[model samples]
Target: MLPAVPDRAVDELGRTEGGPETLGLLVRDQHTRRLLLLRAVLDAAESAGPGVCPAAALARLREDWALLEEAERLEPSAHRRGRPYRDGPVSGRPDGSVPVSEGPRGSVPVSEGPRGSVPVSEGGAVPGNRPPPSPVRALLLHPLTGPWARDTLRALRSGTGPLTGRDTREPARALAHFGSLAAVAAARAGVSYAVRLTAHDGVLTLPSLGALRTGGPGSGETEVAVVHRRGRLTLRRPGEADVVVRLQSGAGAWSEAAAWTSAYTLPGLVLDSAAVPLDDLDPYRTARGGPRPDTLSGPAVLDEADRKHWLHTWSGTAAALGLGGERRLAEAVTLLRCLVPLAAPPGSVPGGAGGSCSGTRREAFGAVLSSAPATATVFAATLVHEIQHTKLAALSEMMTLHHAGPEARHFAPWRPDPRPYDNLLQGAYSHLALADFFQRSALAATLPTLRDAAWAEHARYQAQVGAVLPALVGSGDLTVRGRKFVDRMVEVYERLAEQPPPRGHAARATAYVQAARALWTRRHAPGE
Candidate 1:
C-alpha cells in the first residue's frame, strides 16, 4: 500500500494547527499523486499504438523509466517526495506533474533569501566532475499537463474509432520530450544513449530542462543529432547551435536549466521560481487569451515591462512579509511555486497604496493565477488566502473530508450565491486566514492610517468566519473526519474571536453580513 497520512496529522491540518511541517507532508502527498499519474500516462501510451505514440518514442520512455527506477533503488529517497503544488490547474488541467528533486530525501534545500539576481536555491552541487541531477519528474510533468496529454487521455475514452493522425501526432510529439530529459539523466549518470525528439511549431521542448529550435513543420524530425557518451552531451543538429546547458554539480533548481532554454525563470523575492512560458517551447504553455479553467482569468504572458513589474512587486511583498513576521513570508514561499498572471480586473487598481489581494486564482496544485498587486499588503494577503486553497486541495485529495453528495446549498458569507459544500468549506477556511492576516497587520502597522485599515479588514473577515461556520456545520456533508476537522477549526475561530473587535467594528461587520444575506435571500432563497 502507498503511504498514508497519519490520522493525527490530517486532523491537525484540518484545524490549521500544523505549520510548514504539516504543509510539507501535504506537498509530499501531492508528489505521490503526480507519480501515479505519470505511471498512468505511460501505461496509456504503451497500450495505445506504435502509430498513435511512436514505438521508438515509447521505447525511450521505458528506457528512462528503467533508469529512474534504478536510481530510486540506488537511492530510494531520491523519489520519495518532490516540491509541492505547481502541477496543473485543478479542474480542466488536473493530473499534471510536480517536479521531483533527484537526490537523497531532503537532499534539496530551498535557497536562502534572494540570490544575486535569481532567487533560486539549488542545493549542494554534485561532488567532483559528475553530471547534473535527474530531470525525471519535470520531464514527465510539463508535457502531461499540456494539451497533448489531455487530448491523449481524452481520445483513449473517446470511443471514436482509431485516433486520427491529428490525434496521434500530439502524443507522439509528447513522447519525443523524453529524449531531452533522458539526455540530462545520461549526463548526470555518465550513461551512453541517443534519443531523437521531434518538434512542434519548430520548437523541441524538454520540460523543466530547456528547449531547442528544431525548425520544421510540426511533423518532420527536427533533431540534428542526439548522442550521449561518457559524461559528455553532444546534441548538435545541422546548422543549429548545439544543446549547450551548464549543469550545476549539486542538486540545482530545475529553473536554472530552463535558463539555457526559452523558459523565463522568475527572480522571486526570497524564493526562486519560473514563469510557465508561452514560447512554443512549452507545449503546455497557453497563448495569450487562451482557454483556461472557468475559475481563472486567461493567464497573461509577461512582456519585458511586466517581468520588471513582477520582480519589483515581489521585492515590496518581501518587505511586507518582513513586517508581518518571518513565519508569514516563509509559509507563502513554501506554498507557491508558479505565478500565472491574469489581466487585472477593470474598475480595480493593480497597486493602490496597500496591495489589492484581488488576484483571480484556483486551487491548482501548481499555480496561483494573479493580477499585479495594488500594495505589498495585498500581495501578502493574496499569498495568505491562496495558501489555504493549496492546503485544502491537497487535504481533500489525500483523504475524504466529506461524503460524496450534491451539496451546493450552503450560504457562504463571501459569495452572493449559495456555494457548494466544498466551496463553503474552502471559503470559511480562507476567511479564517484573512482574519488572522488583518489582525497581524493591524498590530504591525506603524502608521495610524495603515493600522486602522488593517483593523477594519480584520473585523470584517472575522465576522465572515463567524457567520459562515454554523452554516458549514449544518450542511450535513462532513464525514466523521470532516466533522472533527470543522470542530477543530471552530476551536481556532473561537480563540481568534475572543480578541475584541475594533470599536463598533463587530456590530458593523455583523450588520453587513446580515444585509448581504437578506439581499441574497430576496434574490436566491426558496420560491423566490
Candidate 2:
C-alpha cells in the first residue's frame, strides 16, 4: 500500500568480494559473447546431473580459467577476478527439493564378494600396483582421500561421475579419511562438518565436506555403511566430522521444499556438515565493533504496565482508523507476537546474528514504544506493515516444505480449503501494507518525520519484491490480475489520504480497502 519509490532497483544476483563489476564487464564485447556461452555450461551442470554435466562444465570452466590466467599474466588485473568459491559439487540434488539424505535415494548392499587377496597397502593402497576391481571402492577405502566420493569417483575413473575437476586419486584419499566412521559419528552429533582439511596448495588441494556425521569422539563404534543404493554412505567417527557417502542416482529432476522445518520433522535426513546452529554462530565478544551483548534465550516478556501502555496506544490509532475494538486489538497483539517470533530461527534469541534466516535482529517493541497518541499511531502502522512483509517469508518456507513431501507439515497453512482464496500469509501482508499507508497519512501533520521514514522503508521493500511478483504468480510474466492487485493498493493509499480516520470497527477497515481496490480497477483494466 505504501507508494513505491522509483529510484530503487532490486539486485538479487550474487557477487563475490573482488569480482568484476558485472559478468559482462569482465570481458571484451566479443569475449563477453564467449563468456555467456561458457556460463551456459555452468548452468547446464547446475541444472543437469552433476555426475553427467559437471565434467563438461568443469572442462569448459577450467579452459576459461586458463585463458583468464594467461590474460592476467600478460596484463595483470586485465579483468576483475576474485578467489572464487569453488562450485563444489551441487548438493547432489536439484535446487528447490529437500535433500532427504546426504546422497541419493535407494539402498545398496555392502559388497561381500571379496576383500581382494592383493596385499592391502600399509596406507590402505594395494602393493601389486594392480588397479583395484572397483575404482569407486578403492577411493572409498583409501585413507587421506578427499571429496571425490563414490559418485564423483565413479564418474571420473569409470565414466560415472560429473567431469568438472581433478580426476586423480587425491580426492579419493580425502574422502577415505573424513568418510570414515570416526568422521561420520562426529558429524551426526551436529558438529561443523566442513573444516578446512588442508589449504589448497598447487600440488595438493585441501577438501571440505558440506556436512558429516561421526561417532562420539574417542569412543569406539566406528564403521561405515553405504545407504540409499550406494548413492550415499554413512560415515561415523566418534568425535570428528560425519561424512555422508552420496553416490550418483541417475535422476536429474529437481524439486524444492514448500517450507523449511526443524531437523526432527524429517526422519533420516542428513544435515549438511556446513550448517551450524544459529546461536552457536557469531559468538558475542569484544572486537572492532566493541563488546556485543549475548542474545537472550527467547522473546522477552513485557511487564503488565508496559503491556497495558502499548495496548492503549495502539487502541487509540485503531479507533481513529475505525479499526479500534478491545477484542480486535487483542487479536492483533497476539498475532503480532506469534508472527514476530516466527521471524526468528528456531532456538534463536534476541541479538543473535546468524540463523537459517538472514537479517539484523530488531529491538523489542516495548523497548521503543511510548504513550503519546502520535507515537502510538506510528507504532501501530509500522507493526501492521511489518506483519504484512513477513508473510512472503512464511509463504516461501511453506512452499519449500510442501515440495519436499507429504510428510512435511509446515505447509498446513496453505492447504486448499473450501474457501481456497484465504492465503493468511499473503493476505496479512496485503492488508497491512494498505493499513499502514492509511495510518501514516492520518498522522502526517504531527509526526511528519516518522511518516516519511516509514513510507520510504515501505516503498523500498515494495520495489525489492515488485519484479518477483510474476514469478510468485507462476505466470512467468506479470498477469492482469497481478497488475490490478498493485493498482488497487496504490488507489487505496490515495483514497485514505483524502479521508479522515474513521472511528468504528471492522466496517471502517473493510470499507477503506474496498473503495481503494475498486478505484484501482476503474483506473486500470486487468490488462491495462
Q: Point out where model 2 deviates above 4 Å.
A: 1-383, 390-478, 500-528
lDDT of 1 by residue, 188-244 (tens): 444445545555566666544456655645556665465545433456666755665
Our tally of clashes for model 2 stands at 83
* 425-500 per-residue lDDT for model 2 (tens digits): 2432344354444444435435666444444433433332232233333422233433333344444444534543
lDDT of 2: 0.28
TM-score of each: 0.72, 0.22
Off by over 4 Å in 1: 50-57, 63-134, 137-168, 178-180, 184-194, 209-262, 266-281, 285-291, 322-326, 345-349, 352-366, 504-508
TM-score: model 2 vs. ground truth: 0.22
lDDT score, candidate 1, position 499: 75
